[model samples]
Target: MSSQAAEVTEVLVVGAGQAGIAMSEHLTARGIPHIVLERHKIAERWRNERWDSLVANGPAWHDRFPSLEFADVEPDAFATKDQVVEYFEQYAQLIGAPVREGVEVTSVRKRDGGAGYIAETSAGTIEARYVVAATGAFQLPAIPPIVPADAGLFQLHSSAYKNPDQLPQGGVLVVGAGSSGVQIAAELRKAGREVFLAVGPHDRPPQRYRGRSFVWWLGVLGMWEASAPPQGAEHVTIAVSGADGGHTVDFRDLAASGIRLVGRASGYADGKLTFDGDLADNIRLGDENYLSMLDAADEFIERNGLDLPEEPEARDLGPLPADALEPIREVDLAASGITSIVWATGFRSDYGWLQVDAFDELGRPKQQRGVSVEPGVYFLGLPWQSRRGSTFIWGIWHDAKFLADQIGIQRGYLEYDGNGAPSNFVPRERPAVAAS
Candidate 1:
């Protein structure tokens, strides 16, 4: 090993995505000396990983973090992937966030003698008083293990999908009927390719009800503030789309549009894809969840005495024509002329670089509201990190700010009053350092 000396800093933040930038903003505001180390360029995922026509699932208004709002874009409009990337880039510049791009962190471990943490990165070594893992929750794309390596089909995960033209001219099988799956299927169909979608349990909220957008209703109904996982309930996956004016996609609509709605792909058998026959049950479950959300919205409006118009009785769901609800159990890949498969299965967190015992039995970090049990360690941009919206762009600001204060307090730069409020804050006088 080279005898190079390790660089030192007060705080070191990994990943310069929205969460990292937000944390940098708070740290900067409080005069904390920190450097954000990003493995790629700022907003690299939105820039490279996402499809060309992808848009934010939430409206532009709700996508803003603290002290930064989408001024030029329409509030109700969904931001395209490019726009979202530009927004983050501009936000980083606006706040003058000290971000070092293309610095890949290899490992993070506690320093000897309880001094601090040492991070081994592509650049060199870095020792910091505190380390914040702001890599976000969607680190690794999770394709099902059942997908055979030698399936011989051109396969792409949703993160790698750009457009339909990239695939060979043949039928495409899109797995996982979440937001990514439905939207990608629509794009493939629009490109004049035959599409087959694997249906699963998901929520199908309409784009709008009455005169307001569904997101507006959710905001007004306090849905964003609800505690996530709901006190022992597993995290729910809602599959509403942001494309085509935020229309909801379901098996019925997809089937009506001439896209085959198959059951969840179970495995490969004898050159054929096996699937469970649960299309109808999945659709029924989705409808139940949709209706429950509507009821909750109605109750919120009634309880708060809001003068909103009644939901229109003629609300259209664009369901399938009576003949389109057939259950499909299997598909012969070769026989059906299928050439490409897109896995829209969700992502999982990969904290293999972390050398701390901060994870739970489920391999998730055991933290209370983003603060780790290990002092001076923290996490940001995790789903349900603190509340229902913790993972969303609109929610990370709160967690970032809170973690900044915690770091400040630990460094003796800030103190909490008896009422549990931060007071008498003072930033350190040392010159702030930024990684080159």
Candidate 2:
């Protein structure tokens, strides 16, 4: 830390991933003076943390910012991990975003006897009238400690997982049936390794349906506008893949392809692992959600009187694979020959440096849309922050725009009426937007 006086700015944006870049873009458009502080290189998680075989779940068109996109890749194709990172790098350069990389913010708090906030960082302290926490979603990977530490099985989180060869030579057990787990299981099975997938509550939507991508259908069906999850459907994840030109996610398909299907990993004791007994019901629910999505799409097409081809295979998912119906309740690790476990159980917020009283007990920010209870402090890039789409690339762009708009209101650069309509809005492009 520098012993000099604190550096001051009009706004300070944290984290230089998609959300931060998006926020920077909007601030630049509005000619607002701001500085973006990054803990590492831009798009660091996508560049280093993700698995080697990782690909965007959404298609390229849906996963890019409005101004820039990936070249040479098909619009319908999902971006590879490298491609996604490269895209962001190019986008940041093109937008001329003020991203000061390698500067990590350790603590952010209200300034004493001042009208704004102060961010303590590795470089020095930064004072700003407003701060946008765009640290992104994958803050910390959540790995449950269900199995004992001395269980003697090699285990790692999905964030640390790369290719199939990184694991031990024996079989692998992938817990959590979300996008990460299923993709890893599929990749391992492709590598001739016996894989056991622990199924959890997931909505297995296909990569495409009726001559359209699943995300396209969601956009058309107005499903992405949902600000909150329906009752009992909070933890459910859509398990579709965009690797190898995209495909549907089917546990039965995985089972038929030599990968074993099991229930959620519940406990392990007496040298035997136990799974939940509701495997059948879980599979049944996934099938229902799958068909219902297609049904809803079909109805939307019919209601709108659109000429589109129907996919017969999507309409009928067929019976549950016989193996999926049988729950693998308990299996001794030695007996099953399972040598490794991959916990792709998703992530949780890791905002210890954020010292504002705007978070829930679970460390989740308490906010409506991107605006927090704390004035001049905002959040971005959270799923369903404003809508379900807010988590996706373009959605993050829109969310960032909304946050920038709010900041614009605060900066007196714009104004909004009570109904949330902009009363006097002007976003000019002026050089040197950020002040000392």
Candidate 3:
């Protein structure tokens, strides 16, 4: 390896996704010298990994960075993958974000004697006083290891799946009935293909309730603020779709849309895909949770004495009928003429390059919000980093700005109060508060 001069910056932010870009904007606003390093182009994940037809899970009105809402676009409409990519690109330019694309950070290590940290990247070494691991949570695709290698069927992870045309002319089995699986199954069915969806544990909220978006109700009930998982608890995967119209893609909806629903894919056996015999139970659990959320929202409205219209009782939210609750224990791919298996199992976090002890047993960073254990180290774009909205496109900016303020105070670029806190530390007001 050839030795090169190490470029130094006040802050080095890894990953140029929404989180990183947002952080860079804050740093720029504070006149902090920082550089954002990305392995690919800005919003590379949305640009390259997501399906072509993918849209923002949230509405355009809510999917935005601070001070930069979607313009000339329908606020209630969902932005597609391409539009999202373009939005991030425009945001980076608009904020004058100092980003260095195509620079992949290979390793990050704390410098000797508490000086700072050194980041090894393809473009050479970067020494920074502060290192913000703004890499989004989804670092690696998580396909179950138990998938049969000799199944002799084409396989694609949700991150790699583009469209139904990419699959062979046969039935498709989609494992994991989360957002990705349900959406892909819906697309496959729309393309006139046989789709089998393996149901899993997920939250099934109606896309719209009482003539308003379900997200609006969630905001009304403070779900986003209160939905943070207990510390060390696994985050719940909410099953919702970003497709046109922002429909809810629950197990019931998939089953009712001519897609066969099965239980959780357990493993392969007897030359077939084995599933648990709890399909009905899983569906019931989702329905119960959904109803509970609605009840909570109703209670919140009543308690606040809000002048919202009364929602009708006994409304049909489109769940699976009792007769469609038959459990599917196994599926023989060959017998069913299934040619492809789409694994929407979800993503795993990878911080192997970060040589720091700030990680927990599960390899997740240990932090009280975005500030890591080590001084001058921070994290961004983590799910539930501070609240339920921390990982979303519209929500990460709050964490980013908070981190920027902290970094500014640490670097003496900003002032701190007598209480040893950043003077600029102030909670951002929720936009939905007035509207609700």
Model-by-model lDDT, in order? 0.83, 0.87, 0.82
lDDT of 3 by residue, 1-436 (tens): 2288888898999999999999999899888899999999999999999887888887788878758777666988888888888898999999889999999999999887857899999999999989999887798999897667676889989999999988989999998867888888899999999889887777778777656677787777777786467454364567888786787655655667788888888888766888888778777777887788767767877797877676665245565654346677878888988899999988988988889888899998888888989888899988888777888876789889889888866765335545675655544444665645
Q: Estimated TM-score per prediction? A: 0.90, 0.93, 0.90
lDDT of 1 by residue, 1-436 (tens): 1259989899999999989999999999989899999999999989999999998887787778857777667888888988888899999999999999999999999998967899999999999999999998899998888758787899989999999999998999999888899999989998999988887767677667656677777787777787666553354467877887676555666776878888788988788998887777777777776777777777877798888788745244456434236666778998898999999988999999988888888879889888998888999998888877888887898989989988887876325545655564544457878998
- The worst-scoring run of ten residues by lDDT in candidate 2 lies at 412-421
RMSD of each: 6.6, 5.9, 4.9
Better of 1 and 2 by TM-score: 2
lDDT at 111, model 1: 93
Cα misplacement distance, residue 256 of candidate 1 (Å): 1.2
lDDT, candidate 2, residue 307? 92
Clash number by candidate, in order: 0, 2, 0
**Judged by lDDT against the true structure, how good is candidate 3?**
0.82
| Residue-level lDDT tens digits of model 2 in 10-122 | 99999999999999999999888999999899999999999998989888888898887688578888889999999988999998999999999999999889778999999
Clashing pairs in 3: none
Best by lDDT: 2
Candidate 1 Cα deviation (angstroms), residue 222: 1.9
Off by over 4 Å in 3: 230-233, 304-314, 317-324, 413-436
